[model samples]
Target: MIPLYLLHITTVEHSESLLWTFLTCNVFVVTAGIVFMYKLFTQKKVRGAGIVFGIAIAINYILIAIFGDPFDLLG
Candidate 1:
């Protein structure tokens, strides 16, 4: 994610196409993560790391939803 953010910061000024690509990929990845987590939850497979990951994703999603990008807060 940091690499993608860095790429965005570096290339966003040079290419609108890359910017759109980045947005599309980001959306796809986040959607995929959500679906995967839902499947894990439904299947009762959320073990130790899964529990940590799910909680982290949920917190980040909530923070981003309410605050309009809270990655800086995470840092």
Candidate 2:
């Protein structure tokens, strides 16, 4: 809700669809951080870190990979 709250604070009239937009972004980031940190703490290989980071980035862009647009922030 940071983006929406910030936008709200800034008083910009963002599309109402921003509720989902922010949710998706938060889920992507939180999942990545949790999974990556888990693997980092559990795994021994240095590659684990790399893979985690890559997956984190990939998760954020998975929509673009499949849907074409970067993020459907509006709708």
User: What is the lDDT of every predicted structure here?
Assistant: 0.52, 0.54
Off by over 4 Å in 1: 1-12, 44-75
11-70: candidate 2 lDDT, tens digit per residue:
333455754564565566667677677777887554766676677666546633444333
Give one digit per residue, the lDDT tens place, for model 1 in 1-75.
555565233321434554456555456546657766786778855565465556656665553445333443343
* Model 2, global lDDT: 0.54
Worst 10 residues of 1 by lDDT: 7-16
Off by over 4 Å in 2: 1-11, 44-75
